[model samples]
Target chain A: MEQSFLAYLRGRTRNLPSVAVGIGDDAAVLNFPGTPEFPSTPESPATPDSADTPCLQQVACTDQIIDGVDFRSDSQPLASIGYKSIAINLSDIAAMGATPTAALVTLTLPSLNATEIAGEVYEGILEACAEFNVAVAGGDLSTYDGPLAISVTLLGTVTAPWLRTGAKEGDAIFVSGSLGGSLSGRHLRPIPRIELANRLRQHVNVNAAIDVSDGFSLDLDRMLASSRVGAELNIEQIPISDAAHAMSKDSNRSPLEHAWSDGEDFELIFTVDESDAAALEELSADDLSVNVTRVGSVVGRTGLWKRITGSKLERVFPQGYVHGETDE
Target chain B: MEQSFLAYLRGRTRNLPSVAVGIGDDAAVLNFPGTPEFPSTPESPATPDSADTPCLQQVACTDQIIDGVDFRSDSQPLASIGYKSIAINLSDIAAMGATPTAALVTLTLPSLNATEIAGEVYEGILEACAEFNVAVAGGDLSTYDGPLAISVTLLGTVTAPWLRTGAKEGDAIFVSGSLGGSLSGRHLRPIPRIELANRLRQHVNVNAAIDVSDGFSLDLDRMLASSRVGAELNIEQIPISDAAHAMSKDSNRSPLEHAWSDGEDFELIFTVDESDAAALEELSADDLSVNVTRVGSVVGRTGLWKRITGSKLERVFPQGYVHGETDE
Candidate 1:
C-alpha cells in the first residue's frame, strides 16, 4: 500500500510557483516571499512586507489519534482529546526546533449533540492554543461512524531551529527534564516545551534534536540516522517518572526499560559539541532551571548502544512506535 | 459550542509575531522565512534540476465533508473517501486563482481498520497528491464516535491570482462548464479545477473568483461580499447538469432548485471586466477547451439577484444546504 501510494503521489503535476519542497519528505518546507499579514478577505490586496530576507520559512507537521490505539472514548475526555491532538503536533515542531505559530483542526464524528461536543473539544483546543499562543484558524468538520477522532496540523517558524542531522562525532547528548514513565499524567497532558525549545534555539547551538514520541531508543535512532552518527547512553543516568517506577515493579519492567521504550514523554533530546557541553550543562543548571544530564556522546559506530552496570555496552532494541508499519 | 470555542480562543493572548492573521479571520495567514528545498534525509540533497519554485506565496481556503451529509461509509470506498477529502481543499485553492502546492489532511475516524483500510485511505490520498503534484507534507489523525469525517488544509501560490473584490461594475460573471444538480455523481467525485485556474490565470485578469461548493446563490453572494459589489444573474442561462436534472425529477425538487442549492458542484465561478471578459471567454473556449459563459454582471446592490422569465429580478437567498437548518 505504501509503495502504491508513493508511486501514485509521484505522478501528479504541480502548478504552483513557490512550492519548494512539495511532498515526500519528513516535513514540508514552504518559502513565502517576505512577511504578509492576513488579508481581510480574498479581495484584499497582497501587501508584501519588506524584510531583509526575501522569503520566510514555514514548517508544518501532523499526527493521528485512533480509537483503540491513541485513546479510548470511555477513558479520555473530549477536552483532553482536543488538547492532546494539538499538543502532539506542536511537539513535532519542537522536534524540528521550530516555534509553533498556529494550528488547523479537522474533526470526524457521529450524530450526537454536535454543538455540545464542539464546545468541549474547542474548549480543550483553545486552552492549549492559548497556552501556546497558537491561533485556531480554519478547520473542517464531518460525521463518521465508530469512536470520535481528531487530527491537528500545526504550523511553526524556525530561525536556526534544530534538525535531525547536524550532529558530529564526539558531540555530547542531553535531554530536557526527565525521560521515561510518561504513561502517567504526563502522557495525558504532555507539555509542548515550545518555550524551552525557543530558549534553547536562542542560547545553544543544538547539533541534532528530536522529541521523544516513539520512545527514547527509537527516536534517538532517528536523530542519529539524520546526523550520520551513532550514540551511547548511560542506563543509570536515564530519568524515570515517579509513576513509571511504581508501575514497573508490578509489571516486572525496570525504570530504565520504561524510559527507553515507553513513548509520549514529549521531552527534547538534543546534542551539542563536546567543547560546549560543559558550558551548556552549567547554563542549564543556572538559567534553564531544568536538569541537563549527559547521557552519552556521539560515536563513530552507526547505531545505538547502552552502557549497563558492567563496562560493556549492549545493543538496545527500539521497543517504540512506528507509523504505518503494520505487522504483516 | 462554536460560539463558546470562539470566545475561549478570543480571550487568550495579545497579537503574536509569526502569524499575520490570527484567529477570528476566515483563514490563518503566516509568513515562512528561509524556506529552501533541502535534502529529504540531509544525505540526499535535491539537485538544481528540480522544477519546483523555491519561493513561497500565500495559502488560503476552507474545507468540510460530513457523513450522510457528505458520504455514506457503507456505500463509499475508503479510497474515494480519502480522495474526496483532499479534492475539496484543492478546489478552494483553485477558487482563489492559486495553485495547490502542499496539503495537510486531518482525519477523525470511529473504528479501527486493519491494514486494508489504511492502505485504501492512503491510496486515495496519494492519488490526489500525485495528480496535483502537491506534497502531503503533514496532517493529524484522531478517533471519534461520530460518522467518518475528513478535513484538508491546502497551501498554494498565486501570481496575479484573481481576488473577490477585483470585480468592477459591468464586469462579466462567468462559470466553468455546467452547474446545478451536482447531487448525483459529481458531488461525490468532483474534480478540482486547479488546472483550469492555472490556464486561465495567465491569459485572463480575473477580478474575483470562487468555486461553487455551496449553492450558486450563496457562493455568488460571498464573491459579491468580498468585492463589495453586487451581481445580476440570468436564471435561464444557468447550465444545469444532466445528472442534476435526473435527481431533481427523482426527488420531486425543481431542476432550478437543485441547481441553486444542491451544493458540492466544485466548479469555478469568476468575474472579469466586460472588455477582458470577451477575450477571456474566447481564449478559454479555444485554448483551454472549456465552456466559459456570461451568467451575470456586477451590479450596484449589496446582494445577489437573478433575472427570471418575465424579465423580473428576484433576490437570491444565499442560503444553501445548512446542516441542521429547517426550511420554512
Candidate 2:
C-alpha cells in the first residue's frame, strides 16, 4: 500500500518537492497509518481490530533542528540535516516504545536559493519516511528571512508505553547500544531502536525509559529524577562508544566523561525490575539486534553515584548540553 | 475531563509557562481527546464507538509563523503571536470540516531573554488551546541564534472531510465573514470558524471549501482550478470588511480590490449546489454567528470572472502576497 503511495508521492512532489501536497487546499487529509484509508463518511465506518492497528495508544513527539545551532549548514549537507530532523523525533517515539506512524513537517527556509534547498532537504526527509513506513501526511512550507529550520511532529502507537516515572527502587538500569561523541557526525544518522524496544517489551516489562539524546548520564539522571529516585552506576560497566575514546584523545576529558556529558548520542536508557532484568540477560545481544549492558541500579537517595574499581563510590553532578543560554 | 487537565496544566505551568511539559522525558504522552483516556495497554484496548470519538478519519495541518515575516515582534505582543500561531492551524482544521483534537507546538527561540519570551508566548498558546478544547500534548522548546519562530501541528478528526475538488458546474460559491485588509492588524486575531463550519455542514452539503488565508480571489481561483471549473464573482456582492475600507482611505486600491487581494482574512469560501445554496439562504445571519454571502458561481469557462452591475464579464488576474522571493 505504502509503495504505491510512495510512487504517487514521488510523482506528485516532482514539481513541489518540499512536501507531497497541494497548497491550493486549506489542509491535507491523513489516514491513520495501519488503519482504514481516507474518504470515510458517516454511512461507511472503519472497522474494529484491523490486524495492523491493534493498539490505539497514540504517542506524539516534536523537535526542531536549526541550521547553525544544531548543525553547521556550511559543512553539513541539507539531506543529512533533514534526516536528523526526522530521526530525533523517531528516537523520541522509540523512547516511549511506540511504533512510528506519521509525521507533520514544517520548514522555515533561509533567504538562499530557497526552493532548491527545500527540495534537497525534503529528499532526505522522504527517504527516511519511506524507510520507516511513516507517511509524510502533511506539512507547511515557507521561506523565511533567516536561517533554515525544520520541525517534525511524529505520531505513533504502542501497546504499552514506557514512561520516565515508573522506576522502582530495585529496578536495574540498562543502556542500549553505546553512547558518546555523536557530535562526530553519528548524530546525523540515528538508528532509532523501534524494533528492539518492541521485541524487548514482548519479553519483559520495562518500568521506565528515555532516549539518550542529550548524553547517557544526563538523560538517565533525568529519568531517575522523574521517578523520584537516584542511581548507583558501575564505572567499568559503562558501554562507551569508540567515538568517545577517539574524542578523549583531543579533549582533556576522559572517555567516561564524554559518555557522561556529550549530547546527541541517540540511544536508550531504561529501567526494568530485577526479574525482568534477569529475563533480559538470557537473550543474546544478537537477539536484541543491539548491545545492551547493565549500567546501574535505582537507589533510595537523591543524587547520582558511581562506583570505581579501586576507588570509593563518589558523587557525580548532572552535566550535558545545557540550553536556554542566550547570548543577549 | 479537560477541565481537570486544564487545572492540572495551569497548576503545573505556574513557573514554566512555555508548554506545560518537561524536558526530562524523551517525549510527552498524548491521550486522544474524545477517545478513551490514557494509560491504555494491550490488555486494556481503547473501545470502539466512544461517542465523541466517532470519526476514524484523521486530518492534520501545520503552519509556521516567523517574527519578521508573519508578524512584527517589536509591535506585536508575544501572547498575540502565540495565539495567531495556533489560530492559523485551527483555521486549516476548520477548513477541513474537522473537530480539532490536539496540537504539538515547537518553538525556536531567539538569543535574547529566551525563557521570558517563551513564557509570555505560551500564555496565549495555552489560552487558545483551552478555548478550542485542543490538548497541548507535547512540544520542543529551544533557544537559537536567530529570530523567534513557532510551528504548530494540529490533529483533527471528521466523518467526511470537505475537499476542494468536489465542486460542480452551477454550484453557488458562498463566503463566510467579510474579507480583506487583514494586514491592518485584524490578521493578528484570527477567528477560526470551527463551530460555524460544523453548523454549516449540518445545514447543507458543502460541495467544496477553501480558507481565505491568502485572499478571496487567489484562494477561490485555486479552488476553482482544482475542481476543474471557473468562477464568475459578483462585484457588487463582495462583502468588504471595515478594515479593508479603512485601509482603502490611505491606499490606492478600492475597498473591493482590498477585499479581493489582501491576505490573512482567515475566512471560508465554499461551494454548494444551487438547491443547497437556497437552503443556506433560509438561515438567519445570527444562526451562523457570522455573515454569509453568495459571492459567485462555478462557471464552464476556465478563468476568474468579475461581473459588475451594467458591465460585461471581465477577467481578473490573480494577485496576492507572494512568498519565496529571497534576497540571496
- Best of the candidates, DockQ: 1
Query: Per-candidate TM-score, first chain only?
Result: 0.84, 0.82
Task: Give candidates' CA RMSD values in order.
Answer: 7.0, 12.0
Candidate by candidate, in order, the iRMS in Å equals 6.7, 18.6
Query: What are the clashing pairs of model 2?
Result: none
Candidate 2 chain B: minimum summed lDDT over ten consecutive residues — where?
B17-26
Give per-residue lDDT, candidate 2, residue B197.
86
**Candidate 2 lDDT tens digits, B1-328:** 2122223323322221111112111112122322354333554445665545433445667788888878888999999999999899888878777778677777788867776787778777877877887666556777777888889888766655677777799999999999889988888888988888889978998887888887888888877887889988876798999999999999999999999988898898899999999999899878877879999899988789988557678898876764553334
Docking class of 2: incorrect
List candidate 2 segments past 4 Å from native: A1-55, A307-313, A325-328, B1-55, B307-313, B325-328
Put down candidate 1 lDDT per residue, A167-284, tens digits, no spaces.
7899998887777777767777888767777677557788888888878888888788767889887767777778778778888988878888888988888898887787776684
Worst 10 residues of 1 chain B by lDDT: B35-44
- lDDT, candidate 1, B67-173, per-residue tens: 66678768878888788878888887787677676787655544455335545766787788888877666554444345556677787665455656567788898
After TM-score superposition, the amount by which residue A242's alpha carbon in candidate 2 deviates from its true location, in angstroms, is 1.0
Q: How many residue pairs clash in each candidate?
A: 39, 0
